[model samples]
Target: MDPIDPVHGTATLLLIAAAAVVVLLFLIIKVKLHAFIALVLISVVTAVAAGIPIADIPTALTTGFGSTLASVALLVGFGVMLGRLLEVTGGAQVLADTLVNRFGEKRAPLALGVAALIFGLPIFFDAGLVVFLPIILTVARRFGGSLLFYALPAAGAFAAMHALVPPHPGPVAAGTLLGGDIGVILLVNLPIALIAWYVGVYRMSKVLGRRFDVGLPSLLFGEENDGTGSSGDTDTKTQAPPTFGLVLGLLMIPLVLIGFNTVLSTLIESGTIAEGNILVDGLILLGNTPVALLITVLAAIALLGTRGGRTLGETQQLLDSSLGPICSIVLITGAGGMFGGVLQISGIGDALTTSLGGLGIPLLLQAFLIATALRVAQGSATVALTTAAGLIASQAADLSNVQIALLVTAIAAGATVLSHVNDSGFWLVSRFFGMDEQTTLKTWTVMETTLGLSAFAVAAALYPLVS
Candidate 1:
């Protein structure tokens, strides 16, 4: 669909965007409306209020909704299936037990977080978190404390990697738009992301975890375990638990495949590998997130699902059950995307960008602020990063490569913060963790802000040195 020009001035668009978000929060938080219905209803109202042509309103709504689902549905489906198999087959238990043994009970959360940082390098946040759900639950259930202790560190680590590092679209797109070397951006930002995660995410999790005693959510894997490593699954109770090595190998499959794709794609972009090679194309297809996850699910069905006297029919049932719990989650997330899409098409982000572009702040600060505004406006971090980078590109022409990379870091930091009602990620964490909207705001939202601020501080301090 073609972009729709704003029929009103910037102020009117901004007001409509703000009013829409307020009404959305009111509907969900106050009126007790189902998030999916509220999001859809508000999306329709917002489209009309923002002056979207009556003929194009449906297209705007479905475009955002469908686009988000296209990325999310398969990942969530395959990921939950993999997680269910791991949970029921005791693969998650094996991994959790090994980590607890090596790291000791006290350091289990840290161990999970460090592992997620590694896995997150090649995986996006939603997929990585979904795949890690069982392990996190297994560990948290064993340790008997707030789930936040175990969940936030791991979740935040993935968020950090996804937002700041390459091979994840946000930073990669920002780096490209700003003419930063991808290799340099990766090398430079990796450590910064780690530091930011440690300071902002890991450290804050301890505080928030202690403060908020969120229990384990039973949404995905059913009832809590009975302390016998069985999550109330009958087949799992009789089957011998999977070996730690086998569990680890199953988890590593996607990581290795996705990493191969990232490396190969980077090489091709750098002209080290020729494009149009049949083998490379095939490998890249295998490495696509959904395809890689699909392959992993199939492998799990063979190795874990049917190995312990469980029939294929039983395995299919297990996978089938996983989808039911996630249907609402999937819909709510898509609707959130729809609302954001309406805002984007209505020119809220464009209005904000135009207004902020001339603000007389320092270039790095301007970059961060613009990205933050766009993120807050439209709820997509990738959109924020790419849009903000393009907006600042001409002004940054005389800067050094290192300076541009630092600017990219700043943009990423801004995009990372302030995820709220409009962001699909906010709902993903809220539903998965079983936290209500307000609770999610207090914990996940706050952690994201601190994480972004920490990253921006690092980038700002380094910007002058590079100059």
Candidate 2:
């Protein structure tokens, strides 16, 4: 739908937007409302308050929600399914073990972190952490040291990649709204994520690990099993685990495919390659993000599932299980888009641009600060990233693709910081690593802040250079 003419003056629209955000935070944080419901409710209320006609409210809501899901749902669904296959088939264990063996015991934490960065490409933070739990605990038990040494690096890598990289919902939604090329976002952010992880998470973790000697928790693995060092699954023990090469190869498939699309499209745009050729068209189609991930998932089902002797029915069941956990993530993200849609149609974006434009803050920094505020208020990084992107979509309309990709990176950086009591990931880390609230605040929260800062720093430095 076209943006409705501003029914209210700039001051009034800005106030309505601020009020909507405050209510959103209160509903989610204090009243304990679900993010999806809270977002929808606020979208409607904000629309009416901002003088949107009653007839247009539903259209605004659905337009934003549907558009977001169009880009988000399939990628998230297929990505998680692939992750579940890897997790269940012992792909994660194989990767970690191979890395640790090569890196040696002295570099176990580095090895685990590297494994997580690779494994984390298709997996969400919580699921990846859960899948890697046994491996992390097993290694910690063998080496005997602060759990922080092992846990923080691996966990932080997942956190960084999930926030910064594509195929994860947060960056995907942000990139879509900001008009970024997902492939470019993926390619650019991949190296930046690795650098940020090393400096912000890896180096800092070493210091924190030494300072806090957090003992291993008996939550998942009991005492005796630590000595026996099982892979934590009876099925994995019976079958020959997938080799490290197979696991890495499977993970690389989508990356390579998507890279093909990005490089070809760039060449076509530059007039280096004709766009109408059959082979080029076929390659680009296969390289599309959802299509690439779909191909990967199908390949995984065959190679990791049926080839391993599981029946098709069993494989279907495994893939189906992965979807269940991500439903909330997908829904909340769609709702965030709805909220952003309301803002757009209500003319708040224009008002925001006009208002903030005078402040003389760099757009990159502005994006980061807005995302940081939303993240701290609500505790969902996906919500913060998507909503912030929606709010700034108008301002970003004229930016180069590279700049928009950088904006997504900057927004992601903001959403990643200051994960405290409200963030689910914070509690997950606390309970899994057996740290208390205070200790979690001291370590995990600090590391998240550093990680976010480092990512933003990289994006900020790159922003001026690109344009």
lDDT of model 1, residue 39: 96
Instruction: Assess each prediction's global lDDT (C-alpha) against the native.
Output: 0.91, 0.78
lDDT of 2 by residue, 296-322 (tens): 888888888874577788778766755
Per the 3 Å backbone cut-off, how many clashing residue pairs does candidate 2 have? 0
TM-scores, all models, native as reference: 0.98, 0.65
Where does model 1 exceed 4 Å of error?
none
lDDT of 1 at 10: 90
How would you encode candidate 1's per-residue C-alpha lDDT over 149-240 as one tens digit per residue?
Answer: 99999999999999999988888888888887988899899999999999999999999999999998999987877766788866563778
Assess the local accuracy of residue 450 in candidate 2 as a C-alpha lDDT between 0 and 100.
95
Best-fitting candidate, scored by lDDT: 1
Q: After superposition, how far is residue 299 of candidate 1 from its true place, in Å?
A: 0.7
Candidate 1 has an lDDT of 0.91
